[model samples]
Target: MAATEGPTVAQSSPSSTPLPPGMVLGPDGKPCRTCTDWKSWSKLAKTKKAQTQQGGSGSESAGASSSSSAGSAAAAAVVTAGAGTDDTAVNATAPDDCPPDREVLGRATWTFLHTMAAYYPEKPNEREQTMMKSLLSSFSQFYPCGHCAEHLRDEMKKEPPKVASRMELAWWMCGMHNKVNTMLGKDEFDCNKLDERWRDGPSDGRCD
Candidate 1:
């Protein structure tokens, strides 16, 4: 089978040579493509021959140039794949591409959840509270990304959802998101800006 790559992997750091050797695998012992970013998965499939050719070249400048060119070409290929109707590859999309990957999907999901949380009533009646709790519980159970869902489930066990008020829920969700961000080695977002970032625009009217 001809291998196609993901968008993120098309242009990777030098430390990620050849293939992504550090990808986390599932209990099935295969790469969890849904949980793993497209870039890492794409790296794993790069041809050994091309890697050898780059390594064998003597000139550092030439190798660097070649690598950059290759990365651009890979990015283009990813863009093309994303636009096309090909179902083989996953998570290789340009800005205008189709079939969003894990990263894009995650961003979209978080946006929706945060917005929903922000709009939640400050004092929800019992029925509203129960429904909101059920929705979150269902999300943890049925999130498309299995490993992600599992992590959420485990986190929920230790720290249950705080649905007392909109502000409380938003803060609680922000904290939960930060935990995941920390796990992924991403910088923690300031919970103080949850309203500015998610609900209200920044004070400067920049968002307007």
Candidate 2:
């Protein structure tokens, strides 16, 4: 009797390499055109496609949620990230803790008065004269004679007044008095009395 033949391996063509296990040669003797390992490849392709679709859908949903209400979107994002709401609450209440508006205004007024006193100088021009008068007048409103007497006295000792016009001298004196009053936080004294005592006196005696 003839010996029984085991299953024969298909011969590969000269131009083709042999297929791996679980693969077979096609009629052309190339690896099989039909996917022999198709199950895992198909599964992986499906998973990747699903992931791409899921990512696109997630982005669209996020955009829609944000458009629905900006504040709600922000709150949702914050909560989803595990942050607390205390910071927002604190920011909302911060303005209430500020100082009164009037006190701020008073401080700003005093600052302007002090700056003008330090920088303003007598100029022969009409504009300069007008500005000096205006500055002095504004100062007087905030710092009357008695309020500023001590500061005025100190200033006079530092810089004696020269022979300027009576009006010019008065303006200088008023500015000095305002400076003193603002520093001391008191009402200014009488301008007429100051003038009477110091009109013929040395420039430094205006404060005294």
Candidate 3:
């Protein structure tokens, strides 16, 4: 059977507050809280003020005591959510080492998907091709960003995955990514450089 499970769609909370400009919408046309930047999700300022205790001269990051008793708990949360948000006002600004937010999460996910496509078998067998297609479909259903999943699912329906060869799938995935980047008002990557970006690195041997 095909992957049919998807996020439980719901309406966005109807409050006096309006969604921020870059807000993401779910399949049911609701504001997707998990798919939006943390900053947009709340109106409260997230930057933390430096503590001014007497004789305390170190910044938050430089402080050796930064790892409080909550370190393990925070790490576990990050492991499960793929990113951690400091809910406390005192720690609102994400630490330099903290987990990724929505934007960071999307970038990392795209990198993994593109790289995997680049390395797909040159001539996939029947089982491999079917599995690759299924993987894409299932990923669209369960992707963390609801709007992104909807967009990907719609795109997949319009143009099914091309798994005839590694190069074909790689190029197709690149084009789809560029579509997303464009919609997000970001620069579109050059499809011709897929191998260089994901597989071989640059020709300058910088990665070597």
Which candidate number maximizes lDDT?
Answer: 1
TM-score of 1: 0.64
lDDT of candidates 1 onward, in order: 0.65, 0.39, 0.62
Worst 10-residue lDDT window for candidate 2 reads 1-10
lDDT of 2 by residue, 35-108 (tens): 22332222222333444444455565666644444443333333322212222321211143443222233344
Q: Which portions of model 3 miss their true places by more than 4 Å? A: 1-33, 42-93, 96-99
What TM-score, to 2 decimals, does candidate 2 have? 0.22
Stretches of candidate 1 off by over 4 Å are 1-19, 22-30, 44-98
List residue ranges in candidate 2 displaced over 4 A. 1-100, 122-124, 135-208
Tens-place lDDT per residue, model 3, 11-94, is 223532233333455566665555655544432111111112211432344564455323533433332232123334223334
User: Model 1 scores what on Cα lDDT?
Assistant: 0.65
- 176, model 2: CA deviation in Å? 6.9
Instruction: Rank candidates, lDDT, best first.
Output: 1, 3, 2
| Model 3, C-alpha of 11: deviation from truth (Å) | 14
Q: What TM-score would candidate 3 get against the native?
A: 0.64
Tens-place lDDT per residue, model 1, 128-161, is 8899889999998887666678777778899999
